[model samples]
Target: MNETTLPPDDFHCGYVALIGAPNAGKSTLMNALLGAKISIVTAKPQTTRKRVLGFYTGDTHQIIFIDTPGLIRPKYILQQSMVTAAHSAIAEADAICVLIDGARALERGDLLPVGLLDLLRKAGSPVFAVITKSDLVADKKQLLPMMARLLEFYDFKAVIPISAPEGQGLDGLIDELRAVLPVGPQLYPEDMLSDAPERFFVSEIIREKIFEQYRQEVPYATEVFIAEFREEEKCDHIAAEIIVERESQKRILIGSGGDALKAIGIAARKDIEAFLGRKVFLELHVRVRDGWRDNEAWVRRLGY
Candidate 1:
């Protein structure tokens, strides 16, 4: 057995859950902090389905970030699971980062985070209000009122504004989040990036590409599963299946002359090879699972 080395005395370990509305840049912030792409991202919002852990090890602290699915009003059985997963992290985490769109907060009166504040009222964890995408705005001062509103009704440890894509305010975010953790030994190996298995990531990579390549409800209704992943001497052999709720959706994914499926495979292979640091031979199959998202048994099997 391979023994693991523990960190020296005075090390800190804690879980910080990132919670917010769709498109609030939680995954981007997580990837930026870890300095690696532990969570797959796309232009689409609500792309993350499960709780993805990104571990950051520093000199004195290790922050285990829970990149959760975006909080939304549950409309379907699948969405109910997503919202449940987001709220469940509140109890497990020592701190919470409520990321909000600075511009959206100002224009819409920050209703989403305000509604979610109820979940953290008795959480007993330090919550931080992080305003993302400040680089795109000219008036940074507009964020103050939003911060003020959050502070008025919520118990936030700090209010920080950051732009993950532009590499701004991340140091302060990391430092403050790390400061709240309790002193303990290292929770994981120093070299590990995420707690999820490689198969989970393989599925996520395929799902991310599906989100990018498809439009409208297709991305929302689709799910990807890696049925097989085997590493050979020369390359990794991965077989994945895309499941949709209807047969019509399957046709859209396969496309005319199978061009769309071919494109998805090409794009996913490139990313899988980059992520694994080895060549990957990826094969995809399409299946019609009628009402999978709505059925409790099917949703459970899909890992939602």
Candidate 2:
């Protein structure tokens, strides 16, 4: 059935926003929860620059999880847009899961950012303190004091520790989230994983490959735009342009004899084909956009 079709009378549905700092595993958690990778994850901070929605449909509930950009003070137009997308998610959510990197918080001895805490206070939604990457913690005993420290800041609906990769605490987290959802019909089809189109995910797949292959500022400076997507009987033809800020970065991305760009293309094409479940003829190009990150129009045009 489609999204418009009504579900069983006892079904529950609502939006849940997964909010956290950069590298806090928000994307990982969403991918884990949905059992699909709608959002890209990388070691780099701010890998997610916009809101990605994943639909988790169960017999009893449908949780629409909004994976947001990491919360950070914006220094430029693009960053400002990222922060805005996160804020917008917070406002739209019925519940908010504040993901705290378990290992990182334990090392720093801080639970929540002062600014983020203040923002959550006014969010008008049930806030959940989710300690992510529990598998990384050497001493599980340390979590008690961490949870205590977290409570000292704000009253959380629940404090849950989870390792997304191990499937630890995922069931409990789902139960907690499902319990808060309002009784309603499904907002999306049970078979539908996400509302984002194929083209958007295609661009994201290419961008993720860039993030994986490049180092330092190259990945952050680069943005992928799908210039052409054509469906043929045998395979899909896709052409993408990687936008960078400077010619030097372009030279670096292309490398001597165009080796680097070719490597990215090869890796990206494999994943893209797997994602689409079809053969793909992929094309890649690099262009200099000169301070595109700071330019408001450029940032908006790039689909940030």
Candidate 3:
């Protein structure tokens, strides 16, 4: 590791779960802290579906970072599972990171963090608040009130203001995390990066591209599933299915002469290659699976 990313002590190690409302930049923060893209990120809310683990190894400590789904009230069985997974991380974690967007302010967004903090306090978990996107908003004065907003419900061990995308206040956040880490042996190997398999990441890459290219409910209704993964002597080949609910959504995804699908494939292929550090042949198929999100059994089968 470089001097800039160095951890405080060689002997500190612990599980720090990243918890927050939707689109609070937790995944971006985890990727930045680890100095790698261990978690996938997108503009849409609830981009993360499970407890993705990103292992960051320092000279002495290995921080097992858990990237959780954004906390929201469940409207369907899949959403309920997501919310459960989010809370499970908080319950099991040695330390908790409640991330929020500093530039957006607190009032405009959903206050799910308020309820989440109550659960954390009741469980006696040490909590820290990280206000993300600090670089977007110029007024530093808003930070005090933002911190106060969080403090009103529950006392945090530390409150860090950061722009995860711009890399602001990351040092302070890491320093605070290091101080809270318990003395223990590294949980994962030094070279090991993430717990998610290649297939899972492939699906996420496609989904991220959908979120980037599509608008509104189209992104929310879509889910990517890997149908085939094969390796040739020359290159790695992958076939993935993009599931949507309606035929109209299918038309939008495929576009004229399959242009839209091609764009998503190209973008996703680039990311897949970078993640695998090898040449990749990405093929995408868009299909309509009506009401898949609302169906509990289908959601579980799709690995959501």
The sequence of per-residue lDDT tens digits that candidate 3 reaches over residues 1-304 is 4435544445789889999988989999999988888777888898888889999887777788999999998998778889998888998888899988776664475434657756887668788988888887777886887787778767889788888768888878777877788977666778998888899888888888899998897898888999999988888999999999999999999999999989999999999999888899988888898899899888999876
Best of the two (2, 3) by TM-score: 2
Question: Model 3 segments beyond 4 Å from truth?
Answer: 1-10, 106-114
Considering TM-score, where higher is better, how would the candidates rank from best to worst? 2, 1, 3
Tell me each candidate's TM-score: 0.95, 0.97, 0.92
Against the true structure, candidate 2 reaches a TM-score of 0.97
lDDT of 1 by residue, 81-112 (tens): 98889999987899999888887766766545
**Model 3, C-alpha of 167: deviation from truth (Å):** 2.1
C-alpha positional error of residue 12 in candidate 1 after TM-score superposition, expressed in Å = 1.3
Q: Write the candidate numbers in order of decreasing lDDT.
A: 2, 1, 3
Best by lDDT: 2
Clashes of each: 0, 0, 1
Tens-digit lDDT string for candidate 2 (75-152): 999999999999889888999999999999888876665588777878879999999999999899989988887888
Candidate number with the higher lDDT (1 or 2): 2
Cα distance off (Å), candidate 3, residue 97: 0.4
Per-residue lDDT value at 81 in model 3: 84
Write down the RMSD of candidate 3 (Cα, Å).
4.0
Best by TM-score: 2
